[model samples]
Target chain A: MSLRPLLIPALLLASLIALFGALLLGSTPMEASRVLAALAGMADATDVTVVWQVRLPRALAAFAVGLALGGSGAALQGLLRNPLAEPGVLGVSASASLGATFALYYGFFSVSAWLVPVAAVAGALLATMLIAAAAMRTSSVVTLILIGVGLSSFAGAAMSLLMNLAPNPFSLSDMINWMLGSVANRGFPDIVFAAPFIAAGLTILYAGRRGLTALTLGDEAAAGIGLDLRRQRLLVVAGAGLATGGAVALAGAIGFVGIVAPHIVRPLVDHDPARSLIPSALLAGLILVLADIGVRLLPTEFELKLGVVAALIGAPAFVWIAMQRRTISAEQG
Target chain B: MTDSEQKFELTVEKLCIRAGGSLLVENASLDLRSGELAVLLGPNGAGKTSLLRGILGLAPTATGSVRLQGRAFGEFNPQQRARRLSYLPQRRPLAWPSPVRDVVSLGRYAWGCAPGRLGAEDLGAVNAALAACDLLAMAERSTDTLSGGELARVHCARAFATEAPLLFADEPVASLDPRHRFRIMQLIRDHVSTGAGALVVLHDVSLAARFADRLIWMKEGRITADGPPTQTLTESRMAEIYQVQADINGNHVEITNPLP
Candidate 1:
């Protein structure tokens, strides 16, 4: 009994429900009808402004970021043949964050708002190429993770250096806040900036799904099955880089949605890594929207960072998933 | 002995493959023709696997050219090469828990159609492969849950699904039970009977004597003997190359002593 036909629709429905819930929850309780009216262009000024200018774009951006991460994570797991492979684990997000922060420190955003994201994407591509090179040299998961950790630590240090060299306290705090990763005060422009890259990245990943499936039998077998190994590596690395770079550019390095979402949905698709992409993306969008709503309603001294809240939920989920995998393997043995 | 066939041939000439600046296979030349089964036998470090990989173009060769069906092996694109030959490596490499049917269908990857969107012919081929390997009942099961013998059968089924003219298997019966060893050997013979050729590596001389149409003995990166099983597994060659004293008795090789 294949459940794939039901899985995508079920996830899309859940995502829509979460998106609607997110749009209805802010400082003031906007009625669902009013939100719908504003969406349909028949609402009053305040309602229209609240729904259109404030809530909708942020929710969509959060969803888009999650979609990118989750899709990339699933694709990367297939590419690397490791269930734990993700953008964060490969240092892609961290390197992109460093690039964005570097652009901010040097006032590139003042010259052109597009510069930060462009820089971020470039940095992500560079990191992805380096990691891909290292991965090609060895198939050991621990060695790949170690290389990624080294790259991540280096990127984190570079970001810290940029903060230290800031000329003013305003600049320092600004960099710090961006590093915290939030979707607040964002408009449709962020979505516009990210959508194309994410779309392109997803297309590349989608094209490589068959090759990825062939790779489940390892490199030689994959080649014997007519998959060009170098081409598959390029597709996956470029796709993951574009998606993760665009995501970090918009949302400032939100964590764990990539790692967590795929784990949540892998079983539904019979553990086929290639088939897990869309469902994982849908579930991740729902998770991010729900987390964004939770942050808005938390009633803290200050609104929580989207990344902070996500890590708070996701880091533990990652630990639990890892432990669960260990138990499963133990039982199998 | 289909070695005289002119329609399909894989020719490896003056092949030299190296890894980490050391030669693994040197000046090895062999020909595989349709409807022939050639079993490669060698002791450990004798470069049997390297020669197989070299012939399949999976390893980098220092100086050599492999021709498949009269086309230079390197000149053929991945799809063309895959359509000409299928290789089952020594490793059991079912990493994911993909369904048995899906995994088997992956053999047709060179057909250039999506697995889920397989044409009727492709689907028929996949079904035939599953049925041929006696895995029809386990088609829906996940490959991760399969036993060692079942996994071997599934892999063999995948190779069979290619329907290519030439097959290369490295130590395909390394760790199987006696029943499965017999089954895998019979499966290879059956594949060769279908007018395709197979080059399989094995350590068991008795099994090789039973199933192989020809035997090629390798020692230290060179071909020591290449002929029919009767002529290649002589007492002196076995003693000299494999350091074993063997007695050949009517399609069975009995190793009598390990020469020190």
Candidate 2:
């Protein structure tokens, strides 16, 4: 049998292995037997505290954030019918980061931790709405992409303005660290705050995946085949918004995972956008967990940030994929 | 007694289509009955495509009413409309390099079946369409690997797989070779012979004269003539519409030269 049928299952197995490896390797390494016993709640108190309190939430947080980005990326690429379409490139992640930064700058997190996530979701939703509206008004794909670029630039400018008027160095540093993105010291409460939005978003994306499949035939033909363009746009925008917002809230602005994971999984799924969703999500989650593990294993004096590590790996893959696409198109021409 | 073939499958009345602040089709009216193959003929800017789009509700209609099978067009939802009328647009856009079988299976979308998970009936329909289009050999190949003519046939197979009662094809034979063009026209003719209706746009006058049961001629957003091919296509009409001298024989049109 071909490798297509075995891909998702293999990714699942890899994810389990990665999660276990993440629990085992940290600043203070522990034995596998002790970690398994601690997971079963029969180990010493120190092992239990370290396993249950410290590593478990951080690992799960990284996986969940990856799931959000990868799934959203696949959906957006299908909707736009563009290989390069992703939350980071389309401005949704940057907008969500701006919202979280706003909350951080204004001391809203001091009042309640939930405010940051809520603000990020709001930012993502607003950006998605603007893009969807522009999509309806024009039939040009380049125009829609340019609008996204404009939105990203505007959000970046607004973020810089907030940083320029910081009240204190402590809050400014907090903003900077959040922007860089890491899962260290993350607890269950952080996961609890972002889980529902992510789940809802992914569920909606799964439900509307058939629309993405129909969209392979282009917009007018898809519409002619009884696929409702308006409804499809709504599902993609709202789903991507909620999921990316939650990821930004949980980890903060992780980029390129969305683009790279889907690109890798597309060929495996035979390039059907509907079938690519779950595999892309699984592969991306595995990638982030592995990246987090790499972060801990490095010999740097200071622990590396997860977002920085992800970009360091993902940016190169992105360039390679772009080059591969150019070569294919040129060959076709 | 009037048979089932006499019943009207589609009717458009006083339709006006507008785009970019200009009227594309103005006060156009036509009716297609079961088992009838109609061809639309026009100059480049004569609004043949616009009329088809206006009737299908794909374009912005300023004023018009369409009825399919005796029911108002607005009464049916998108799925219901798709089951009744299938459209093959001029521009064929395939985003990804999906396999040919997968793309053809998308015709079953209105029936709630995706490409990988097709029911028995859907699979039968897809296989039949592939065979009809002579694409069974390329079923496993990616669409991006196909030539221009092959891609056009793929889109045609996708439309045929739907098996809708009414088919509207916009320049389906534009990119095809002579043999394939005749093959596609014969396919449409055969499809209508099964008590279905088809309205196709064609640029080849000889092909339309041979296959189309009726001809509808449009000029500057208005239809100027509508009838059987022999009566509608004449020397004077050709000169008036195309500004060319032409000789019209039985199922053959020979244009001598453009009028200076």
Candidate 3:
């Protein structure tokens, strides 16, 4: 049999096995047969609750959110034509955090959980508009990147100031949760809240994939291929905003999947930016799910936040990719 | 290459250019007919690049109007204009290693060809473009991994894939070797041989004279001459335009000015 046909299915199988194992094994270990019984709808009440209400939703959230981040990151990097570009680089996540913080600070969540997501979407859109306005005119990608960084820092600092001024425990909790980005305690409603934006973003990106590939050869060539620079940039901005914002609204600040997933998957796809999307989504979901599973596995009396492990993995990877690109740029271009 | 068939016509009137407080090209007007292989010849900083940019609506294009195929340039929608006219800027800087096949397919963006996705026509166009540029062997190779000559061909493939009626390229041969220069010019000529018009800004007058059906010679913000190569590319016109002495021994012109 050709190994090609087995690649995705094999990866999926390995992931499913790992996920199943992680779900069933822990401080309260469930037997494989019992887990299968639960899966097959023959389990008793307690096993059904444990498997369905808690483990399954958490795992699905981890996978779906990871998919959003990974796909968004891949698309963002290609659209920006810089491997270093990420959702955080453009301040989308920070803006979402600020929005969620604002909602909780004002007791919007006390009225409704839906309000928090609305706030996040609004904030993300505003921040995206600001970044696009500031950086759209210049021919310099470095300048655009720097503007994004500056805007992200501004949003982060503002978020910190809001956190410090917080008068209630809800604001503090919301800020912390938003920053750390967890998929815990999520239900189907949370999934519903995020699905539309992520889908829209991914669609916009997928639509522009060919253009992103063309851009890798440079702007003039991309234009020669009939891509209008302004229109393409607009699409990229809207796509990244919708995706990163939706993911952030759902899971908080879940860091690095967008950056790490694309970089890790690019080589496998032969350095073609468009091909990075599918593999990136898979890798991203796999990483987040695994990380989420690890958080449950940790022996700490209090749960270790998912973001801490992700940061540990992502920070080093970011540094390595940055250093690698800088060293290779002189010889490559 | 029929004489009767024509699609896009670029007309510029009283085009003046001043970049960074220096007048580069002044009061240049041109009526570029459709389906013609037009080449701009100029010395360094004689504003060949500016003129091309002016035509593409890239430059500020002070005190002038550029009509694309009879319509005012600004009146057309940006995407609609892009579909009709395409531009390749000078010394393209592609920093990443995108595949050659993927790079050429960018031409479908104005048409909104989505990712992991292409229709039969798109694939056919991509394959045909690669073949036209002789990049079929390196279709899957990383574009950034190629030599300069190869990179130029990949860009040509991209331009060819655009399927626009008018193509504008600035200094398409600046970094190319001699053999590659000939090849690039030939490919560009082939592309223009279709109903599509092509305008290339070049520093090499001999190459322009050899390849282009119509020559545009510019100096100090003006079109000093526009005609056939045999009439306008004489020794005196070369000396006057370049501010130096030159000799045209045959079809080739050599500059014999004192070394600066």
Candidate 4:
């Protein structure tokens, strides 16, 4: 029997538990009773401040970022009809990071905090538009993936050039921190700024979920089934752009969660792309939350960056997933 | 109107399809009525598939006027067109390992039902399609595990599930064994007998002769013959279109040898 019916609810529960764990296992660890009391607004001001002002926003930010990445990854995988497609692999996240880097290089945060995310969104939209235009020109999946690699290389070079020309050590360090990707010191304002874009992006992906399912039969068959291919491409591209941009703005640039999350949930849903979306998002959120907790718990002079921790865990998972796919395809052949 | 009295017709006029700077199908015209199964037969690269795609408006550079049931094809939106006409292209690679039932249920997409959320009517259509294609036993099997012939049947079942008035299939039985090949053709024949129309592309002349109510022979982007199978599947016509010496005995054709 298929486990799809229970997958989403289970992921939701796991995400809540992980979020609670995030709250309970911070630098200043608190008892479960104390944390619950703080959540209920029954604790003293200092405890409430620690829970509400500090851990809550950080946890929520991590979840939102993961939600964006995971949802975008599922939408893109469906659109491209490739299991490996994701914001990071498609160069969208890198482009968004370059935009954020530019914002940091120019001291845009001092001028207005919102400008950073705005610039990141603009960068993501630009990259996604380029990819979408190329997709229209070619029906070749390999060509699209190669073009994404080229785009990513160019963006990485641009970011490196920006960092190399930093005006001061402080600016260079700031750029490095942004590139490393952390949810540390994130506050309610950051979540407030990024939430709408993330919400809108996920909403768009959700609306186009059925089209993604139709795409599993390949492009010609999908169009034969009466799906408007152009419209579906637009929805996926635009949704992934907004979501990835929002994610980068929220937590620098986290990799692999997007790819790994959907891969984990796909089998549960019998590999149905439409059904994998929400479950992927929830699982990714849980992963990032757990990663954040790991980051805090590690014994180190400096707290581990969430992106670093994610890459540490996720890159291996990515390779394993790729190897598994190769084995399956070879077996089928 | 009762099902038997309902009218279904597809008309194509002066259809031209160009691809990569070369004309693939030129000035093709045809009409199909309910209770008719038309098989398109030609040699390799004879533009049979291109003509079918052109009529379906899937060819990127197709220039044609097509009408269904007396209304212009362009007047309908994509979903509405899908509701009226269902197409089965050459067997395409399945990207995901979704269950067979789920894949077939995608045929109901034009009617606004996604897989796993099918309404009673949509479920009925899906089940009927599976049963029609002899796929009910394997409905829960993952597509990735199916053999090529089974996968081809799954696709045909998907097309059948649409329940559209007109069906355009390109090489629907190309990979099937003889038994399955005949079964698929017979299924199309049965579908057409229910007051619908089907235009199937086939390389097997004998199969086409056995099942098609009408035969359309295309050679190099043009229709060379269009008539009843008995009149169109002649020895001389087969030699002209396929460059083969052939023996035609009633509805069976034996390709004797290829011309030098």
Candidate 5:
């Protein structure tokens, strides 16, 4: 496959290695040989159960959510042509989190375990549809970002109100924990719910790859090149939102992977903004898997939030990017 | 038929375009054909760009119809219309360090080639476009690092890559050096002569007269003078449309006075 098509699989494999490393080498201390042996189908029954049943699915959840968040950010930023744009930053994640909260409050999901992420995806679709409707009016990048921010502020406020009205203190914690975001206890059910949405989002983003490529020349130029700006914008918004919403539902509010991963991987693709998506998705998986491991490896016994870890990692990364951008622009000037 | 034997025409009739609560281009009509390089010349905000946008169907045509190849352009999907017509706006910003080749490949978007791959025709059109604009050497360089003139040429290369039968370029040569400007003018003129139709907007009346086969003098939201460039660049029409006297001698029209 000449490493082009294989790039994703390779990155996935590397991420799998890292995920295994995280599982095998946690603070609990499992032997490396035992870990590899279990993974390689040679471990005893107890080791196999520990490696396969307990930790494997959680690792899978991180990978899936990370890929969605990263890919969603790339697709959104590409559609808006704004580096500052991110799925969580733009409010899709919050909207879906709110959706999950609402779904929980009604006791609707108490009757069914699968309803949580599904409700979150619904919330995500609503937010995405709204953003698309508003952004389609103007082709300006600034206007699109501004509209995203506006929608995000509204969704955030509504989500806060929903938090206030939670049926009980425990429900509030559930809501809070959901917003704080985590991939720790996620199982195959979460993956099944989120995967199809992310897959759909990827398909749309892939389909609009040509338009995104054209848009780098500016909207008029893209139009000149026969790209349907409105249609492409709508598709991207929906795709980015759906995938991102699914992640939010599965992981709560894992932050900055969507933004930082794309920025980090841009250099790998020679800065072709359109081709940055695949690498962004892969790198998101890498960063998240490593971050999840760090959460497990923390000195304290109490589990720290994964979102906190990401913010800690991503905040510095964001600052570095801003500094780099300023230095580059100053040099250019 | 050879490009020389073919004749493509663009017809804009009863066209009206409004923006920001004003008629930027109203009741405008014009014709452009092969063997004719038309220049839409006027002062800034004289509706030159608006008229161009209307013909390209980018602007909201409140009233009017544009015909490309005698087909109702209004009925053509925007992308379908874009396949036959190319446009160069006054300014375009590269938000990323998009490679010059990748930028130009946008012109082949109407071809709808698959991602991570290009077909033979798409590759040919891209290559021909790069060759046409003389941008082959720097095709691998990032456009964001290009100088203003180089970026202009890169955009020109992109527009040409569309391989459209009609071209609407708005101040395309504005930031170019004299050498590049002259070369670009010659390139536009040659392409027009080779069967494709073009309307190039210009502020330099003399260049319009010297290079364009026809003149479209847009003034205050309308075509004030439209005819052969030599016939239209006269003192009265220039004074009427531009509100300044023009010194017209044979094919030359000077907007600036000589040293006393």
Candidate 6:
């Protein structure tokens, strides 16, 4: 039996429920009716402020970031022909985070709220273009992945050096907090700023979906099937860069969402790379929103970092998937 | 243009392929036409695969021109090229566990239907291919669950699903059992018999002799011989090229290498 007919609707519904549940969580639990009233634009001013300004924006930001990560992850996986490939695997997230950190260090955040995301998007495009150039020269998946690892390590070192050379403790703490990843204190403007980049990335990925599916047969066969492989690679790389850069700009370098989200959707979609994209985005959005709520509800003095909770949940899930793949390949072989 | 040329014809002239400063195929030329099963046979490192890749435009040509029908090979758009030919590489490990039918439908990729949403025409082609490859029963099975032979048949079905006038297959029966090897060879022969062009590479000379209408034998990046199988697969030629002793009786060939 095929579950695909039900999977998309089920995921969309689940995401909606999660978003609603997320809106109701905080220091004081609000009634669903009041939440619904806020959504319908008929709530009192205090309720409207709490629901609209605070919870709604954070929820939307989390969802948008997840959407970008998920779409970026699925596209990267298709382009590299490796299930383990993700936006972070190609160093886009790390580079974007470094760009954001540079913005904070130079006080660009104070100048214009959009400058940090702009820098992050620039950084991501730079790293992805480098990777795409390397990919053109070599057809080996291992070589491409190794190039990504090198780029990621270099970006990490650069970020560490920036933090080491901070002129003041205040800027250092701010950089540190951003690195931890969060959806807190994010206003509606942040979501608006990141949405276009994410939308462009997702559109690019969607356009390449068929070619990506054809590529599962490998490069020569894919080309025979009329897929312009070079063009396909560029679309995936550029798309992943824009999406991941925007995501990191809104919520720091949230690790593992890209890697974990696709795995969750692959089985439900019969493991078709093309079919997995939208579903993976929805699932990732749901996962991030729920994680954001959990961090808020934690009993700690300060809310836990969103990235911390995600990595905590997602890292183990990634390990489990790797182990499962090993066993499956072992049995098949 | 003549009706024959209008149908399909791929002409390679003085094609040379170089990789990493080493010449893989040197000044090899061949004309592939509809209604023919041409075999490329050679010993290891003899540039057979390189020649095949060169013809498919997967390898860069140092000094050569390839023309499809009356146009330069490079001039055709991707969809136009794909509509003309389909290729089955030697190593095709279905990366995803997509169902057999879905995998086959990917061959119709040039049609530009929405991904995973096959039209009736696409489904008809896919079913015909699955039936041709005797994989109809296994169409619903996940590719990862298939045996090596089964997976090979699935790849053939995928190539067949394209319904292109020309097909190129490199070592289609490299590591299969005899039953599967014969089945795949027969399928290729059948495809060409319907007035389609086929260029196949095979390590098994006996299979090549049985299935190919014409043979192009290569040695050290050059065509050592090209003719009917009887003329090309001569006992003396096999000894010179393969470094093996062989016996030929009528249509049968037996390789009896007298170890030095």
In order of appearance, the predictions have TM-scores of 0.95, 0.95, 0.86, 0.95, 0.90, 0.94
lDDT of 4 by residue, B60-144 (tens): 6889889887788878888988888889988587899999999999998898978898998889999999998899999999998
Against the reference, the lDDT scores of all candidates come to: 0.84, 0.87, 0.76, 0.87, 0.77, 0.84
Residues B166-253 of candidate 1: C-alpha lDDT, one tens digit per residue: 8999889988999999999898898888788899999988899899999998999998789998777788888978999888786788
lDDT of 1 by residue, A1-333 (tens): 577688888888888988888789989998889899988889998888888899999999989999988999899888888777788777888899999888867788789988887888888888889888988889887798788789888988888888788552345545545565788888998889878888888888888888888888898888887889999999998998888888888888777788898887877777777788889888888888889999999999888899898888887887787677677679767
Ranking by DockQ: 2, 4, 1, 6, 5, 3
lDDT of 3 at B223: 87
Give a tens-digit lDDT track for model 6, residues A1-333: 576788889989999998999889998899999999988889999888999999999999999999999988887877766677776766788889889888867788889978888889888888888877876677666687677788778888898888778653455546555666899999999888888888898998998887778888888788888888888988887888888889989998887888899997887777788989899988899999999999999999977889999889877886787677778778976
Per-residue lDDT of model 4, residues A1-333, tens digit only: 566678888888889989998889877899999999999999999889999999999999999999999999898888887787788777888899899878867788779988888888888888888887887778675687788788778888898888787653455546555666789988999998888889989999999999999998888888888999989988988898988998999898788899999998898887889989999988888889888889889989988899998888877987787787789878877
C-alpha positional error of residue A284 in candidate 3 after TM-score superposition, expressed in Å = 0.9
Give the residue spans of candidate 4 off by over 4 A. A40-42, A133-145, A166-172, B1-5
Off by over 4 Å in 1: A167-178, A327-333, B1-6
Tell me, by DockQ, which candidate is best: 2
For model 2, what is the C-alpha lDDT against the true structure? 0.87
If you score just chain A, what TM-score does every candidate get?
A: 0.94, 0.93, 0.89, 0.93, 0.86, 0.92
User: In candidate 2, which residue ranges exceed 4 Å CA deviation?
Assistant: A134-147, A167-173, A331-333, B1-8
Location of the lowest summed lDDT over 10 successive residues in candidate 5 chain B: B251-260
Docking class of 3: medium
Candidate 4, true inter-chain contacts retained: 0.73
* DockQ values per model: 0.72, 0.82, 0.50, 0.80, 0.66, 0.71
Q: What is the fnat score of candidate 2?
A: 0.77
> Poorest 10 consecutive residues of model 4 chain A by lDDT?
A167-176
- Indicate the fraction of true inter-chain contacts that candidate 6 also forms: 0.70
